[model samples]
Target chain A: MLSKKQARAFFLGGTLVTFLIFIGLTIFSLSKDVDQTNHENITEAVVRGKDLWDHNNCMGCHTLLGEGGYYAPELTKVIDRRGRPYIKAVLMSKVPWQPNGRKMVAYGFTNEQAEDLIAFFDWIDDIDLNGFDRVVSPLAKDKTN
Target chain B: MTLYKGKRRTTTALVLSMGLFFAALLYLPGMLPFDSQVTDSFFRWWVVHLWVEGVWELIMGGILSFLLIKLTGVDREVIEKWLYVIVGLTFLSGVLGTGHHYYYIGVNKIWLIVGGIFSALEPLAFLAMALFAVNMYRKGEKKHPNKLALYWTLGAAIVSFVGAGLLGFAHTLPQTNLYTHGTLVTAMHGHLAFWGAYAMIVLAIISYAMPNMTGRKLYDTGRGRMAFWFSNVGMVGMTVAFGVAGVAQVYMERIMKIEFMKVQEMMEIHFYILIICATLFTTGILMYIADFIKHGQPTDEALIKE
Candidate 1:
């Protein structure tokens, strides 16, 4: 039995309230006091690495922080699971890196660019993922065990 | 501006405009650097999570309402009123439902509780949508001869409820998502959700508009009807394939603690099935395009009646 006027009121009112609360929560969570991302460690190399990650659309296959195409492995704890040298070799390799039959596009990154991506991975490996790090890469857990 | 020139401003316009505003807001989170994973991931949901679940639902509701009004010959006042209620339910549940993505992304524990409760309610909006569409069809005195369009319109509502509502609810909770978060399971839910909700609605509109614009009443053709069934059945088959592969991956990778690559290799068969189903889906789409080509360019003669 709701009239159009009342229904419109409900829509506008509900939207306004929820939007404000969402903004408030965003501000609260991102505030420095509750920070869990190790924000201070983002160096120039890490920024460049992120640029490379985005530019190459690495997320087209690989997942970082449990977010990406599921076509590739979860790279949230990649540095811990696979050593830097192995990752570097893959990046610097002229041909595609086919580990278990899945082919990865070979960027043939220079040493410095590879190092920057490694730094980015290293930085990512350190973020507090609310225990998702433990869940995503069991190899890290095995190492600790 | 020209579209709205002589027409009185309606609720559909207002809701759709609001959806556009939210779409523009999707850019805000992307401008921030990935400097802080917590902040970056947190705000990233403002785009990713908000779009499909939040404002996009508003857009869907608006379009669904418009379609129901036209296809069912329902009263504008009644349809608009329900549209308001549906949009209300969407924002009420969906805004806080953003917390679901925040559960494991290094945010506070408050999100676990907030996201769990709110996202559980998110299905209600879709349920309301399905009910609204059906009820409007029943109440309608006029049956628009465009049965193909009607099928798509109703299909969008019902399928969205199942794909976006039920399937999304299946893995939305923090406890289940913890195990399934990054696995192929997310892909399973995502494919059907997008196909049913956004993709089907867009197809519905296209189906409705094509004949009117081209002056070709092709809705009764076997090809048109076949396009609907084949595409929908193919999509469902693909969803099952992905679901099977995803569940196997979650069990092997997350629970058994198998290495990611080994688990992926174990699930290669599902990808084959996915490819097969994808071929079926592609065939349907190609047929639809062929039909569209047959409709030819819209002539001024068709527009003259308007």
Candidate 2:
């Protein structure tokens, strides 16, 4: 049997070798699958959509991807849930608060700005997000603690 | 024994404080839906800032300094004052800098400016403590075969302070914070700063304390390096992805004026990067756990066979 020091060395060394192999595999796997649909313009449009989210401070009312304020819908996959015109109509709806006590107060937008918002939403809908949905229910953090 | 007694008392208090803070974190999320922007921000500072800067940091510095004193046979008096200074400065600057988190809460711009500048001073204290630890290590050469654990402890100190404190300053200024807050850039900082400060320090303490707790010859050089690489590399991956996604959000929101829902959809792709990094990070933690569980060879004379 090996000494304590020698056995310690063996386990540590074994772990290192395995970790290095894992690292190599991770890099190799990531490089092989470049999705062709991830084009430049579409990518840029997606980027613009994110900027819009932050500037508006949507987290004030809405939850997205399990992060953010919980007063509004989870919006990680809003495109799948709602249609293009529906999204545009909602943004431009001029009706500002359907009254019965919803926490979200709407911002009045011109029809053209609303259309731009729709275009942004449609672009997001087109991107592949690997199947996360935007639904508003209590999150894991809510249910567990 | 008196010195050890004092150290033990301090450590126990620190542990209690940490446990309380974690309990608070577990409870705070439930407070949402009733969560006001300001109230939530208030608790965020209390949980994240106070723990790292105010309490756990002071505790860690004290415990490590005490260990150094014992290990190096240095007079504990000489180290105690320096430890106090480090801990004191960390708490003072950290608490006042709680104002930095106030920017989004509709606090005055002046508080943000002052908090940003004062928070910048935290890293200098870390740098001095790091230098002192290195100098102490250099003084005590070839003392024990297990001296390597001290080096790991020092590395944890350096990187934790750098990732949590130094890089923290990079995006903390008002201009950068404007673009980054509530974005993936903010998420990146949360990941690195918290993991580096909290996780690495815990690992270092485990490496130091486990041998005594288990009564085994517990130091393993190879596994330590593997854990270190996996964590640090995965952190780098997460940080880069977060940065890219943050910049992307900035372009989309400020420049392109895309709607909020659409921006979120675009940001989903960034989750793939985080998922991969999480896998590597989890693997690293598992390997460390394995090393701890199966500690010593059964037949070794140096180990007390259970």
Candidate 3:
């Protein structure tokens, strides 16, 4: 097995293995995660929708891709769940969206902008994240108590 | 340094600062906001990154030195040598490691390479500390009878390596950082690194110093053992909850391009798990603090050696 002189080797080797697992996960996941590769199909409306999303700071109220304020519901799968029209209606109408007593900032969206934002959501919605958010997390099972 | 007085006085190596570290916590108090999100975020990150890579390391060194001397019963010469090496490694990798903060701050292109390399090395300093502790532990002929203090001392060293060193390097590399940046992945590392390196050490120091300060030999108590295990297990569970939430967040929001708010809703249950875990962690800490208080005010008689 290992000798006293080989202790440094044990340290180096163990650390090296852990290092390998980390970097390996990084490379594998990052490459697979670039799911929206068909930017070739990105339209002007979708581009404008993205711009609106940014300038309006919808992220200030709602989360996008799990990055944002916790005051609003997630919009990542909104298009899939409610369809493009629903998203457009929500943005276009002057509606109150408060979850757990926190208020969302009101934004006035025009028909054209709403159309563009809808397209953008549709574009991103097509990107594959496998089974993410499709159901309740198994890790949350029986532990919510 | 002379201009400062009272609590502001630069005690120890002139680097032990809870100022910037605590100031950074005040920067972002969870669910709070700045009027200008962009500028606000930049400064918030400045607090966090500067803290972990900065004064917190000095705190680690100071506490480790005190504990090693008290527990290891080793020659001061050997311990001080390790202290010098740790301090050197800390500043060397750490200052440059601040560049990692710049990558997210919308700074210059040079920070990409600079932060990447240095931040990667940040773990090396922590690793050295780990090796130092375990090695000294092995070499020492007499282990202190205070079993709880030893648990904490050794735990701080080893866990810091795993949490700060390994988990940190996981995302420190720019190639990975570019993708994992700002996602729950960062949260995962942040929780573990902060808990392992900073929180655990402080607890370890308190565990060591409490008995000395109070002259109470409570180290052998069941409550002491319970406090240690409950806190550690609760934190590890919390780390896992945060990890999955971050991963799901990244996958749903970043990868699948889900509407961000919807993803947050999906991950709501995980936060519930986080709350449960946090409760356990807080209870454990409260138990520790309560026990420390029960010993009453530190007295001259308590300092009397057996």
Candidate 4:
């Protein structure tokens, strides 16, 4: 039978060891050599697009990087699947973009704003997602062929 | 200012403070521009994953211990000892379990191995919790006369094991998650896990505290019992609907390589089922609120004498 003192010690000791290891792993993953994200290509436009994505709560419906509400399509490889013109049309459209009876909120973004969002999608499309992009819904793969 | 109350109070405060600390770390990912997608996603889990699996489990343990002590009249030393062990298991498994999220998100292959094994073990902590609650109930010589609270407490433990433990394990594996990661499958797991683990615990505490505070012994009412059964049944029905829809989605979208919108259109029937179950769930919640209002406000007269 474990004593209360021993149990408390186990709790504290386990937490400390695991937390330190987690931090060490985080550092290892984020190191430049392990970097899979194309960090250098993030331009001002990409940043603005991300701001728009966050501000509008697009995640309320759409998923990005396989994270977010599943109500809408995963947008990780959107640029590869759908051309820039189609996406731009959806964003710049004044009315709600209803696809398959599901309505997307009408942002009616200006052309420049649409372009910025396109840049963000372009950058996201290029990320090496440890085979996730290939294995995610086939729609996530490049259809240019 | 005598801030250092008793051991239990101090420990609870520390556990909640740690949860707050993890919550504050959510700002870290926001500060890092999404340019470094891997790092941003990685740190985001530090907040999202760590809170739900790490610090929040500690808070849950603390509350479970408090509830067990109150409802079962179990010795605090025994309950606290088990609480420590439960939390110890949680951290031991859950900290490394963060790797499960890292598997697909452009990290090293190490997460595939680490996340799979550790997350697989995460259920042991919940199992310990369920067993602890049940064993305490059996060992308790004093029945606290609040059967409704006991139901919610025991339900929280058992349902959390099923929802957070078993269902989470169902998809935590890299191979399965590769298919189910972003699909409605994740939504299926999320709804039940949150409702069972966190929401049920909150409801358990509320059920326990209300009668004592308001001098209203409404725990035995037909509505209170109905609220528990109706809400739980409705939630289970909703989980089933989501699960069926999600599996169909995995087959249609991922395996069959069908168009996404087309598959979604086919799955509209499941959403209708979800809406019906949701209505039942909402009805139960309304009944619970109506019962609470009937209890009226807490008064000094109802205060327990030490």
TM-score of each: 0.95, 0.60, 0.63, 0.93
Best by TM-score: 1
Best first by TM-score, ranked: 1, 4, 3, 2
Whole-model lDDT, model 3: 0.65
Off by over 4 Å in 1: A143-145, B299-306
* Residue runs of model 4 more than 4 Å from their true location after superposition: A139-145, B1-3, B6-34, B298-306
Candidate 2 lDDT by residue in tens digits, B1-306: 443466355432443354455546645633453112233344555566656665667556765675576556555555554565555456546655655665544333444665677677767656666766776667754354454356556766676666667777777776666545545566666677777666766777777777766667666668766877786778778887877776786677534655545665677787698779878877777778878766633445445464
lDDT of 4 by residue, A1-145 (tens): 9998898899899989988988898888777797676778889998888888889999899888898888888888787777889999999999999977889999999999999999988888887777788867765554542
Give, for candidate 2 chain B, the lowest lDDT window spanning 10 residues. Answer: B33-42
Q: Taking chain A by itself, what TM-score does each prediction score?
A: 0.95, 0.52, 0.61, 0.94
Q: Whole-model Cα lDDT per candidate?
A: 0.86, 0.57, 0.65, 0.84
lDDT of 4 at B281: 90
Ranking by lDDT: 1, 4, 3, 2
**TM-score of each model's B chain?**
0.95, 0.79, 0.82, 0.92
Please tell me what DockQ candidate 2 reaches. Answer: 0.02
lDDT of 1 by residue, B55-173 (tens): 88888988888899999998999999999999899988999999989988777777888899999999999999999999999999988999888998999999999888998999999
**TM-score of candidate 4 against the unseen true structure:** 0.93
lDDT for position B208 in model 4: 91
Better of 1 and 4 by lDDT: 1
The ten-residue window of minimal lDDT in model 4 chain B covers B1-10
Instruction: List the candidate 2 regions with Cα displacement exceeding 4 Å.
Output: A1-145, B1-36, B70-74, B259-270, B296-306
Candidate 4 DockQ score?
0.71
Give each prediction's DockQ, rounded to 2 decimals: 0.68, 0.02, 0.06, 0.71
